[model samples]
Target: MNPAEAGPQVERRNATAACVEFVQALLERKVVEAVLVPQHVPGAKVVVQTLVTDPSRLEDVDPVAPVLMSNSATMVSSLSFQAPKGRIAAVMRPCEINALVELVKFKQANLDDVIVIGIDCPGTYEPKDYMQIITAHGGPISEQVFESLSRGETPSFDGYELREACRICEHPSPANCQILMALWGADFSSGPVIVPVDEKGREAVDKAGFQSGNLPAHRQQILEKITSERSARGQKILEQFAQRIGSIEGLVDEFAACKKCMNCRAECPICYCRECIFCSPTFVHESNKYLKWARQRKIIKMPVETLLFHLTRLNHMVTSCVGCGQCSSACPNGLPVMELFRTIGSTVQRIFDYVPGRSLEEEPPFTTFREDELEPR
Candidate 1:
């Protein structure tokens, strides 16, 4: 029987239920040895990534939760380093999927033994903001909002909303992942449809006996609308950033509030390094040097190299940045770190004609060398 014709028989009651059943089927069929998913911790308002080997343990799985405590791509990278024994399914956001693709090109993640399952993400709240919303709701995140999203409705709780990065994200759908859990344009009353985007996903779906269907026609329309809106918003955001800190002096003044704690680097998904040069002894200077600088300038910033640290990070990660905004979310000083990276990184990526995480076939500009690519000054 045709999969689309059989959709009614296999249609799930809700998106969450459909996701749980699909993942459970994958585990039961042994298509993958384990699945990495988001699990809502009991008695806690937080959702975190959990590796599940047992299908029965998926009862608390909520991949659609609006909480982004950490980038899942970095978690996948952590797993990839160990070279796990069997195929592992990773459910991730579109941004996280892109970050994973970039990591694979950087050799920080291995794709041979993994399957990436991406979901249509509208956006998510910062960890703290999500907690506040949950507290106010007197429950876990609202299924009403999650379901409304599938129907193209925007649900808000007072002034609460998605993070800035998510708001301006132009790529809301999956491009690099193997499987895409389609949410938009699907009637939540019938559940989301899972479409395989690659051979790996197709094989897994066939093995798991998932009933598939064509993407809804309205899905394209919805996606295009979202893309247009986000692209415009992204451009406006870049313009505002340029106006605020386009000059060297303006940039210095904006970042002058930096405490030099390196929290942004710590939280960034692309800033992968065992030992950063910023933390090296080379940046450390003798007492006389500090005194000499203070005497020469009458007074100097206490935690020196604040601008240098940002510049070094920008140089190291601009080409690979996926604009996940974890850096800004991690900043203790509320600096507009994400705005700076997205603005400058977008320009750098354009200069190289590269899009981070667009595909595995495209090599990272930093790692590739073509002497004729850039003209000598």
Candidate 2:
């Protein structure tokens, strides 16, 4: 029997089962040596990226889970850096896939032997918020939330909702991915529609021997509606941030609670520096030096480098920010650092007519120069 037919009866199987079966076929046939996908740990509510070598271990693998623990691009970078002997298949969200594209350009990730599988995102919940919702709902959340999102309704449990990042994301469908598995805006009670973005994906599907079909016409309308809604929401966020940080006082006020703990830097996918300047001795000073600075100002903030640290990071990474919002999720103070970075990033990227992680052929703005580019100075 074909792989699709080998699963449960056509009427009973859902999209999640179809997705798992597809990946299992690849593994069983040795089309790829390992698969990098998210799976809920046994006896845990959290889902994490798991590298599965055995097909039987995929019992808990879920690509459409509403919880995002971390950006998986860095994980892919670590896995493929040494030029692994066999091909690897990875399932990632749109933001994670975008980050991987940027990483590929920076020589941090090798995609020549990796297959990128992207899914139509139905947004995600912040990890802490998701855990709370799961506890209140009293069971696994993937199916429940997926059902709500499939109908274009936001999942709500008590007062909880989707993450701010997901609420305002403009790119819901994956772009520049080799294979795109779609669930949104489709009646997936039958099976998923596997759409190939390139020849590699077409070849992969052929090898897997799964049934495929064209996307429903309504899929385009649904995607456009979602994108438009998200764009409007994103613009509102940018406008609010602009008002909040319109001046030095406002900027400082917004970040006044920052502890200089470097959590944002640590979680940012684009802030990939082994020895970041902020973490180095550049910001470290002697006791007397701190005293001297305080004496000069008569009163200095206890942690002196908060503003400088954030500004420096913005300068270094704003062009590459993919709006993944991991930084804000990692912030202990709950400062909206992602908003600041993305707000500035969108403007900077626009000024240079560049969109980070959109395509491999597009060069980063800072890497190129033209005398006439910024004539006004």
Candidate 3:
């Protein structure tokens, strides 16, 4: 059966409240052992993912919150990498689902006992920026965002904007998930339209007791419009960035302020190495080695291999970069790491005809090789 045809619209007035009720139903009905979802932190304006086993604990749940503290893919990877005894459902944004899909291919996560509940994301703010926006509005702004989506318009705050990664993200709608809480072109006042994407999703919807119905008439039309705008914006921005870093000197200059803090790797969901080469003894050069290099060049950056670090990361996972932009948010020096990765990843992924997080059946380009592949290069 086609999963999209089995649309289950949640019957509620407020979109956010509707999503919360649906998640609560999952717990109350025992659809899964636990649900990993975002909730508001008490006494603060922050939102973070929380694993809930009790339905009553869902009072603060806000699955569509317009802020991303970190990519939840890493969290899902940790929980499902070994296949837990009980099934777990993760509510994640489109990018998080994509990143987790890549991790699954790398043997970093197993989805057998995991049910993915993906959400259609318009965009999100950096953690700090989200706090400010919330304060400026004097409260949570998810409802406002949903209202904007219902009108087929991008959500905009007075003085803030979405992160660059989100602005250029072409995949606003999620794929490869068991279930989806669709928002684009939705009638939020009537509640979010939930679509079951697979057998697992259909079963979950049944267990949760949502009646199957037709999807919103214009959801696809609105999604295509959003994707098109983002793709065009991404192309323009990345093209200019590519030209800016065309030369080795230009690339070096762009990363000249790198502190080598490794924050980018720490935030990257695709960089699943338990012990990265950067953290290994391989990069811990002897004192005399630094002195020797300084003498040879008469000058050198204090943290050697800063450029090498970025390059090595690109080589390792650029093919699987989901463009979540957490790396740029993690940078203390405010470097354009996301732009660099997206620009380079666009080229590399195209060369291999791979889109990270697109599917679980397709092997990553790095994992498989064709005898004639790249022979012309």
Tens-digit per-residue lDDT, 1-377, candidate 1: 54222221212237577788989999999999999999777667778899999998887777777778888898899888668789899999988998998888888899888989898887888888887777666655536555766767545677787888988988878788888888878776767779998898899999999966578668888888888898899999889998889888899888988999999999888988988898789988987999999999999998888998999899988998998898989999989999999998988999889999887889888888786767772
Candidate 3 per-residue C-alpha lDDT over 164-201 given as tens digits, one digit per residue, 9 for 90 to 100: 99999998889999998888888876867888888999
Q: Give TM-scores for every candidate, taking all chains together and pairing residue i with residue i.
A: 0.93, 0.93, 0.95
RMSD of 1: 6.4
Best by lDDT: 3
Regions of model 2 farther than 4 Å from truth = 1-13, 152-154
TM-score: model 3 vs. ground truth: 0.95
Identify the runs in model 3 with alpha carbons over 4 angstroms from their true place: 1-13
What do the candidate models score in CA lDDT, each in turn? 0.83, 0.81, 0.88
Q: Candidate 2: worst 10 consecutive residues by lDDT?
A: 3-12
Q: Which ranges in model 1 have alpha carbons more than 4 Å from their true place?
A: 1-13
RMSD of each: 6.4, 5.1, 6.5
Give the candidate number with the greatest TM-score.
Answer: 3
Error of 1 at 101 (Å): 0.5
